[model samples]
Target: MDSSSLLKEYPLNPVVWDEMCVQNEVRAPYHKVYEFLKQISTEDLTRKEEMARRLFMNQGITFTVYSSGEGIEKIFPFDVIPRIITAAEWDFIERGIKQRLKALNLFLKDIYHNQFILKDGVVPIEMIYSCPHFLREMHQLNVPHDIYVHIAGIDIIRDADGEFYVLEDNLRTPSGVSYMLENREITKRIFPDLLPQNNVRTVMQYPQLLYKNNPNGLLGVAGLMSAYRKGNVAIVNAPGNGVADDKAVYIHVPAMIKYYLNEEPILKNVPTYQLNNPDEQAYVFENMARMVIKKTNESGGYGMLIGSAATEKEMEDFKVAITANPREFIAQPIISLSSAPCYLNGKLQPRRIDLRPFALCGPDGIEIVPGGLTRVALREGSLVVNSSQGGGSKDTWILSK
Candidate 1:
């Protein structure tokens, strides 16, 4: 379909010509990108797929996928349509995310030391006692920089009305920031014109931004000191964070925050009841078919039981497991994740997806990179967006023009 016909079917508002005229008055760095995309035909985008493939090959960017055999290396998929972020929008998001992270770090610290929030009833003491993520081992271990969360991924999504909402926070081992940098590079090379005509800022320097506060800053440091410095940083998954990120560990975060931070958490966790709570555990045992039970330490969509999908026998097994060791499990209502348009099989289709925007906390403050990784659940109606599954990704554009 032509752009006009597609717009008619989709029922989107027309671009305001007056705004375009005003935007044109400024000598935007992305003017070349805007002009280029306007002239290219859809056929050009198809041809550019080859350019994207070659770019991935040249850059040696690849991910390992485990299948029947295991350990298969493949290039990360790339899409040509770059997600744009306007400066104004980015500024707002940056501020909100920074505030959220700062609060969360303080909460984590408090959870390990004191029980202030819990005592204040901001978070119930029972709730933390039940969380699997609450690590007694980490109770007094001081983080080197006094920063529990050096990196975080805050997910946000725009509803049909186009207002953004926080979906979830991945405080530990958040991946896919690498893809954001690679995707922009590929989009710029493949369809240089698709960039917004206004003064669209590039997230190209994001890695640098993430690495900027390394004890050495930008001046290349050498050898052991760089290695030994407590703040010496790299983007590899958070060190020793998996313990707390585990679903079981999550049960403890509220307690940890209360114990360590002494302040109430601004955001609320989804209503989750641990199997260890006698009344809640009894309730879950009775209504095993209406909730979602998850193993505390498993990830990548594994060890998850959707009560509705379970047979009587499976439900029985889950009940027995929970009854035997309530601390090993937690249950919550199954969340209906949102969806977005994604390119699949040469056509645009609605797919379940989630966002994971990276946040870096440094000496100055927290900085959330604009345009996070948009992960799509490739299966028709699936909600699991893990790359380990048959999921794919798209470029998230926070448009400046």
Candidate 2:
């Protein structure tokens, strides 16, 4: 089938923005990809996808899912269609992440030392003391360069209007970067000259950038924890970062940007409501169906409830849990995440996706290699994109000027 036929088969959600198509016309960044697809038959695309999958299988690129005290290894899903971002979009994302990190690093330094943000009544002192991740031993302990967040994988999502919002910051051992690099390599094999033809920027520099800063490079090595205790190796992301990346602390990040960096945040945070507040809790309880309730310390799509998708039992269970320990929960409005086209079952389909771009901070500066891991909700009409929750991934392309 022609690209027009493929485009016609792919349905767009009127309420959700599409990355590749706007009113059935392919967007500028996807022009080259669209043209390439125009000449390929549907069978050809399926073959390419199959080839990509086999390569992943052969290469043993997989993630483990734990269940019943056992680990199940599964191949990480790879979609043929790449999620393309323009040069302008990438620049905005890079700048925003850098700005946020600067503030976060400063916040960590301040919190562990003077606790100025808390003392000045900026962030509630109770919030810090109550946080499970806050270590009392870290108080007044000086780290190298006083930098806590060295490497970051900040999760960013686009809303219905195509506006970017940071969903969360992962300052501690952020995962999925290997998949990002491998996706690009796999694309190079499947798409051949398409990447260069589209002027896509390379993500291969990620490893080099990482090693450049970590001369010791002892992460993931056996006895690394013992070495860390002896101060024999430096942790890229220092301890006590949980005090900064805590979901409860996320609400105060904009204030941190203004307080520490002396500038407004370039990217907006998704409007979040702390369930501990009486007013916010009342509002969320009243509009439970339109909110997503999550535990402050949870990750991997666990300990969360999607209100719209939750059953009566799930909602009631969450209500009881939140009421028991109000500080452990927060809620946000259900954002209609932007969708992108995916190749599945020999046809183009729309799926919700989110991006997690890795940013490396060294003594010199912060550098974000172009492109990231584009996680997709493979299920129809789902919003959650965690791999443990049956989500897949797409190659992200950041085009050059």
Candidate 3:
């Protein structure tokens, strides 16, 4: 039999864009590797897939999966077929990312110093003071270059329309970069020639880039912020940046972009409802089952209510929490996050995914690594892709074409 005839059948979800193919045919950026895949026998393909897993195992490339109230180190699930973005798409994404960072860093600096965005009424003072991480101590404290956010891991996602959106920004110390770099190294081994054939961009310089831009050594956000305040040290994603990452503050991002950069936002956020707004809160509470509510300051996927899955007790508890301090929360319709093909149970299946591209700011300026970590919800149909919440990662390829 010919190599094409030996290919294993993989089900495709037509509702979402498949990065590998436009329809049944392989997408242009993936042509080189899809053709290569057609030539591999199923047995040999399985062996190669298994080898990829073994390589991860041997290299100790693992992430802690904390589920069911316990932590377990598991080999981060990696798919051999990478998620590819065209050069045009990447250029647009890069511009949007840089625009966002510039505005956000300026916003942070403004809130801590002049409070201009607040005084001008671009963002409410309550929203600034309402943020749990908003440090009063940061007032009038100056940092090198007036740049507050040295590193940002902005969460990005594509919907059915095939447009990119910034889901959220991780400014207070972004994670998963190690997984991103490792994913590229593994992809190199899986399809050594496919990369050069596709003219894929490299992500190996992220660590060095971060090192060159951020503090040489630091512990926690507050400590680093304190050091920078005293002119004794420098920090990345400088502390008190939580003011921007706060889900409540997230709603004001577009306004912030317009206010600070005076530029329209190239990327947008999912429609969010601030519980602090009486009308929005009423709608959110009444339609609790249709929305996802999150605490403004919480991270690591905690303090969240998946309205569709919440039990009566959980709903009541969340309602009480919202009632006690409404400003601490925000709600959004549960987005049917786009799905991508993932290898699972010895077969290719669809899984919801999200991307987090890291942006670095220095005297040189904002630089985003062309590649990022493609986090996949390993469990069938699950939307939460955080490693702490049973998510795995994949390699992302930004094609030169």
State each candidate's clash count: 30, 0, 1
Best by TM-score: 2
Error of 2 at 271 (Å): 0.3
TM-score attained by model 2:
0.97
Per-model TM-score, in order, reads 0.72, 0.97, 0.92
lDDT of 1 by residue, 95-125 (tens): 6566666666766665676756667776566
CA deviation > 4 Å runs, candidate 3: 1-9, 65-71, 215-227
> In candidate 2, what are the lDDT values of residues 40-111, reduced to their tens digit?
898888889999999999999999887445898899999989999989999999999999999999888898
* lDDT for model 3: 0.82
lDDT of 1 at 44: 66
Better of 1 and 3 by lDDT: 3
Tens-place lDDT per residue, model 3, 12-123, is 6777766665566666776776677667665676777898999999999887755566778888777776777889999999999999999998898888888888898889
Error of 1 at 227 (Å): 11
| lDDT-superior candidate, 2 or 3 | 2
lDDT of 1: 0.61
Residue clash pairs of candidate 2: none
